[model samples]
Target chain A: MITLYDFELSGNCYKPRLLMSILGLTYETVPVDFYPGREHKSEAFLKLNPFGELPVLVDDGLVLRDSQAILIYLASKYDKTGQWYPLSDPAVLAEIAIWHDFANRITATASAARLGLSMFYDVDIEAAQAGAHQLFRLLDEHLWFGEREGRDWLCAPSHPTTADIACFPYVALSEEAGVPRQDYPAIRRWLDRVKRIPGFTVMSGVFPAGPAIEA
Target chain B: MNRPNPYLNDHWHVVAGNEAVASGQPFRTVLFDVPIIIQRLADGLRVTAALAPEKPLPVLERYGFIWTSLGTPMPLFEIPEYDEADRRNMNAGSLGVAVSAPRAIENFLDMGHFPYVHTDILGAEPHTEVKEYDVEVSAERGEVLATRCRFFQPRAATSSAGGQEVEYVYRVPHPYCSVLYKSCPSDENRRDVIAIFCQPVGEERIVAHMLQSLIDDVSTITDMRRFQQTIFGQDKPILENQYPKKLPLDPRAETPIRADKSAIAYRRWLSQMGVNYGVIPLVPRVADV
Candidate 1:
């Protein structure tokens, strides 16, 4: 059995939960009061992850930190198809690495704006919003071209990799940060596709996408 | 002692989908520029203007939508096809448009922009020509009907395997409602029904609720909604930047062609009904100095 040190509202915590739900893995959630209590920064939680970031995942005895890294670990170990992580091909791994880093940028900007607005964290709202827009423009164009090329994910894979999972939360939650996605049509479409994935779940502000047209 | 309230007209507008507002949950939105609240009561969903929070408007749960009218309204229009046992009734999500309610309705009535605005999905560049179609205003029915319309689409729906010829029937049963019956992707003999119910939030803003009654067993509800959302998302940016945010009632305000007959008839019907709720009158040209 796997255990997740979780925060209900945090998008970072949601990434692992979302993937776990998708992979059909059973896990126990130890809810950490991330908002008013700030339990993640407490002494006990810091011992689990010295970086003091959520969410920490423990399976058997191996403890893991960072959302993207946890996603890598989970998919690599659990995914029977070997598709979600796709570590076999060096080229695909490299591509996934690029997007993994990009997800960090999304956390820095979009997540920062959300933290400032909802959680009362002090942040430069203007700069964060601008940075998010700049990143979203690129992602939209990338997905637009990807649609034309018959690719559905961030990397050049037929199936979704960790890259798509890594970057999805902040982009989907950008509106909470005062960033409107009205201009990003392709990104909006991609977000719907992501939400339509089976076993998909919703967070506090993230709503589920409606059904697609029949195949 | 008081002037007439023009916005409080007798028009049944869709406010939300049945799935959007659950029982014991309250949903708030603006309709006809009035802030309103919707709550699912034991009997049905109750809607009322925000000013008078206690009073409830007439509610009708039809076509997978929750509809309410501030004034006395005629019976809701009928779509006989929805009663079919084999069809899947789907409530596509609401889409917010920066343009006026009528402009969004007019856009839905139009086929000319499919080639450009929707691009390869609805229409391609080479198949830009919209063949002449018959359009008429039904005085007895108080509606506008456009028939015998056809177009070639690269991908008609999420179920579409490739390009095919799509037959279409457009109807404007209400000033804010535009319904379309088109070729079904799952079964060639059946017609898929899609309708857009425009909620006029302001003179230049609307929340469009879409419903699709389709004949498909394979596609998930999420896929169906996402497909429609994708098409609307493609149309949003163009709709927002249109000049004269509210649609002009006068025909000469915007040039029309043979393909715009449905749009023409719709405007004429709105004009005859004296529906100035969400329309902008044509501005008179001033003589140059």
Candidate 2:
């Protein structure tokens, strides 16, 4: 069975869990505790992924670190025709890539910065809030346009690709990280659409109970 | 003692009292940091601040005065644009305007439609009278309790035409939330009031924030919640698809029957409040279906 090292509360960790469920793949969750700072920074875990993230996926001895990359890998390995990954069209892939970048560069970073300020460090909260707001506004604008234009999924038309899986968890959990979920109604609608998909499993924070355990 | 004008510092307003001004009189008393007049006539309630020189005499005479005038006459136009803080607070969200309607409280009491439009989704049966109403009120909020009669109806069962008595408890969270309580006569009411928060986003557009809780006692709450979700899902697409301009009503375009009483009443009420009422464009005869 595919092994997913995850923290339930972490949106990044939820990415793989959601994808695994959607893909109907059975995977064993190896729970990691971030409170005591135990497994993340361990030397053996670092050898698997130097970044010390909890969502490191180990399948057939192949290690995947970044959440987006792990999602792409999972889709390619399990799904046929890359419905989630969509390898047929370069333009489609490019669109998906933009959202993937947004998840990593903008949403992930801003969410982490804001979460760090609130949860871990005593950094300038105003600055962190500002960063979070800025990111939310950007996502809101995109979602607003997407909803108005009658687009079915983010990053593509009608069908949800890896791009949606890549970004949905963070955008959904951004509220817990102090990223004002209510401010973005269109994004909320988009999250609902994502939830209605067949074989859908909500990210840990989206619902109180799910397969994943809270980090 | 002279009370400081709360409206001067904040943008929020509250209802102070509901009193009968004259025998056979029907007026809603609203305290907006200042006394205001709300007279309910055959058409609807006409709200005016107590500052206008044109007394209620003309309005009373013109409408063939019958009811009692409750508080002193107030000017409808003299009520200044709310203070900046209230303006900011009110405009903080896109759906704020819907919540700002004076009749929102009354509208929440309506539970007749639970089984019709949202029947399969909410599991409400028609023609059923509410058996019990439990109300809980506090300084911050209030709740109303409603219970439905028990039956072993499952999703697979065909819908019976007969009605079931349902119970409802409405809760208000002071300025923001109005949570519905969960109680079940059979098990327990586990349903939550579907609260709608309106935030003003633009001159004409308001975002509508809605939340409903899952309750255990009422199996119907689950179905009703699903139905509400479906209705909202449909409404969002249509509302979002419409032009951002406030829609006007076209009386000749579509004939409204008794089933549309609530929506029609709400529209008339809004019009009386000086809210711009939009009319849905007339569909072609061929598009009637």
Candidate 3:
């Protein structure tokens, strides 16, 4: 069984949890009190992730840090369809890597604003919110054109890839940081599409989308 | 410090789609700045004001929407179009807009913005004029109505084959609810009814729920919703960037021309009803110290 050094409220920790759930893999969560307790900064947890992040996954004696890296590792090793990571297609692989980097940028801006507001972290809240809006503008436009072109997921793949999972949590939780998704209707619709993915689960502040109207 | 409730306590708001309140799962939402929780039990879904879970709020399921009234409210207004068996009923899903609920309702009632805000999808730059329309208050029915409006569009809706002349009727059945009846692309005699129900989460925030009841057999529910989402997505940014977050009820608060009849009538109706939940209360200018 895999073990996750997790914080329930942290969006970074939610990344691996979401992927693991989607892949239908069971894992044990070792709760880390990241807020008031500040346990992720504890000396013991640092041994697992020197970066002092909320999510550190240990699977079959191979320990991993970084939510994006864990998503890649999990998808590559377990996804039988090869659609999540798609190592077989070099071009798709390159596109997924680029989005993963973009996901980090989301963490720095959207997630940072959230932390500053909810956790009382020292950050330029205005700058972070502004930065998030700039990124969101690009994402909304890309998704809008993608919809017109009949593409659903972030990358060119017909189905969702790990990049969707990497970027979702922060965007979904951006409201807590005083950055509303109101202006990004495409992004909001994308969030609903992401939630409809099988085996989807929610972290705090991230609610499930209503069922799509059917026949 | 204590604060007065900023929401119109007596109005009914669409909180979610009926399908969203599934069994064994709880859905959370804030209406009129009050946190609410809805749970599906063996009998049916139970909705309560979050702070007083034991005290159940009045709930009604209609038009494929689950509605909750935080305070005493009259029965929901009837939409006669839904009774037609040939019509397709769809819940187009909820949207969050940073502007006030009243502003969203006004946007729904305004056709002047179609050429500019909605662009080629609903209208084109060449046809920016909103011709004169009739507006009146039906005191007996307790609603505001605008009629005899026509506009040219490149793509009227998702089902549009190409550009066509579309007739529109805008109606406000309640303070936070606005409905539109537009000419159907498929049938000349039939019209499609689209309603936008706004939930004022706060003075400057709203969650919009849409329902599309149309006389179209060719399109799937998903297709209908996709078309609405795309149109609303285009309007999101413009709605968020409006200078004053609240709807200014005073006519002098903002200039109004002939095309703004619907919006003008709406503001007058809201002011007469004493609904200030999302209206910007005019602040007196304190002479600069």
Tens-digit lDDT string for candidate 2 (B17-109): 122233345343223233455565566434455675245422332111111223333322111222222211111111112122222332343
TM-score of only chain B in every candidate structure:
0.92, 0.34, 0.93
lDDT accuracy of residue A171 in candidate 1: 93
Q: Whole-model lDDT for model 3 versus the true structure? A: 0.83
Q: For model 2, how big is the CA root-mean-square deviation?
A: 17.4
lDDT of 1 by residue, A1-215 (tens): 89999866678988999999999999997777554345688999899988888999999999999999999999999999899998788999999999999999999999998777544466998899999999999999999999999998899879888898899998987876778899999999999999998888766557677799997
The reply for model 3, stretches above 4 Å from the true place, is A1-100, A107-215, B1-7, B282-289
Q: Per-residue error at A35 for model 3, in Å?
A: 31
Q: Relative to the true interface, what fraction of contacts does candidate 1 keep?
A: 0.00
- Model 3 CA RMSD to the hidden true structure, in angstroms: 14.5
lDDT digits (tens) for residues A34-150 of candidate 3: 644466898988888889887899999999999999999999999998999999899999999999999999999998987765444678989999999999999999999999999
Fnat across every predicted model, in order: 0.00, 0.00, 0.00
Residue A162 of model 3: what lDDT? 98
Task: Give the 10-residue window scoring lowest on summed lDDT in candidate 2 chain A.
Answer: A203-212
